[model samples]
Target: MTIERIRVLGLGKVGELVAHLLGGAGFEVAGGDLRPRPDLGFPVDVFDVGDPESLRSELDGFDAVVSCLPYDRNLGVAEAAAVAGLHYFDLTEDVPTTTRIRELAVGSDVVMAPQCGLAPGLVGIVGSSLADGLTDLRRMQLRVGALPQHPSGVLGYAFTWSPEGVINEYINDCEVIRDGHRQLVPAMADIETVVISGDRLEAFATSGGLGTLCETYDGRIRHLDYKTLRYPGHCDAIRFLLDELALRDRRELAGEILVNAKPPVDDDVVYLYAAVEGQGPDGLTRREYVRAWQPIEIAGRMWRAISWTTAASACGVVELVARGAVPGKGFLRQEDVSFDDLLSTPTGSLFRDEVAVA
Candidate 1:
């Protein structure tokens, strides 16, 4: 069989990384973005994401469309992909948008996979894979953080990804399964401290990180939650701003504040830690733990850990779908991915070796 051809939408840092990884894997790669991006290292076909007809025209003749754009724009892209009968994938962590995409996927001829990035993407896969091995699953906790390698700020965090997306996760409603019941909890409300790899970190409920897992494991598990990890004191500061200052009601203002205050950097680290505890076949309790510490590198260019992991994971799933590894129709969740299949893919192998060492 011939290699699949893909067209990646959005030419941001993550989009560029997707194009490079797919191109290296012997796929004919093309890119499309709203604005002209000359630094993408290859020709970027200009197409406005806001224009649905134009997007449909650009996406023609491609096996799949990988969207690295923000969450708000993903619905349109998914619609375009479905209409064109091309597989659709994105790195969104927004709840409502993902819900819409799921609705769009019903009875469609092409696959629609959203939330294919770090927390909602690989973390969900790893956690669910662990859950699959247990005889009687009890609890599952997933924590992921993309932190600056070197910190010098009040928040001790950098804008490694989308500032708006970060704000959405911080302030939006989170879906969690508590006491074997699916519940919606406010983000930044259930703050807790955790120690990983000898470094103290903070974690709290974050929106869109669970990616349909609460419903997937609703009655089977006593607890299932996903949190975003940050350095010590980061949650408190955000809580004060979002809760005390009433910034949660004003998400646009909150996003602007984060954009203006936090600095974007190329030197960052992505941390993933997931733990699942349940009963074993021997009538003994067992636990499965997966941890990954991936640092940033971009061949010769500068790319942060968040950028590399988030972008690569999305592109990796797209590659898998194009190569006929994933089902071609209906709604797809991150947890549906197989661990072995993921490790064999070119871009997905980046996390595979890292997790092996951890």
Candidate 2:
């Protein structure tokens, strides 16, 4: 799979960055959005996501399609890309969407990989890597947060990422492996606190972040869970909207309210924490991987911490699959990618060695 040309879907925050990074990385990259995109100094085109012919023309002659479209829209793009004889990758965190993609991957010659962003992306790769070394795997915990370095507002949060994604996690039931059995847990429950970089943050169960890890490690691990970290009091405020206001039943309104109210911030941070403990050759031991990323300037422009991380994760894999490092066919999982190999990718190396809390 020598990828000489690539097509990126969506020109939103993360999609724009993905196109920029891929272009700078020396790939022949073109970007498409439902509407015309501004001249970002790269090749961008406009197409309707709902029109099959539009997607076909937008994605024509590209070796791969990196979907930054909303989760609900990815299936169509993926089917189009498969028809175009191109590999399909996405940043979606929706479980049902991934399941649909998995079904589409069957008997297809190209790769169909979704949930390639952070949390469901790198976090799974790291957690599985650590769990692989345990002599007797017991419990694994993953926590990630994209937060404002300086927090304010009544919600104590700003949209450094997708507001709809935040709402989806709040209302959906999370899947976790408990007592060696797959279990469904309510979202935004199981409040806990973790101190990273000396900043105390709250964490709770979140849907879709776990991806396929539970099924991949099912019947083997005792306890496994993934949670989202936020500043103290953040979860309670979200709970009020979901429970007290009954906004869970009114997702469209809740999404709009949060999107209109919680403004996006450029000054943001991404916190990562993964820990696994169990019996080892020597004894029971624990190893943790932690990171805190700040916004940085790239290609003569600044990218939010979330934007860069999320895009880089997907773009990095594009390189790996092009080089034949990953399986070219069948549905893929983040755990299917090797941690060391992923870290060796240009984008994966960005978070490999850096300043993270000890």
Error of 1 at 69 (Å): 0.7
- For all candidates, the clash counts are 0, 0
Per-candidate TM-score against the hidden true structure: 0.94, 0.96
Clashing pairs in 1: none
User: Ten-residue segment with the worst summed lDDT in candidate 2?
Assistant: 347-356
Off by over 4 Å in 1: 1-3, 290-292, 296-298, 355-358
| Model 1 Cα lDDT, one tens digit per residue, 109-186 | 778899899879989988888777575677899999998877766699888788878998988889888888898988
| CA displacement after TM-score superposition, residue 334 of candidate 1 (Å) | 0.9
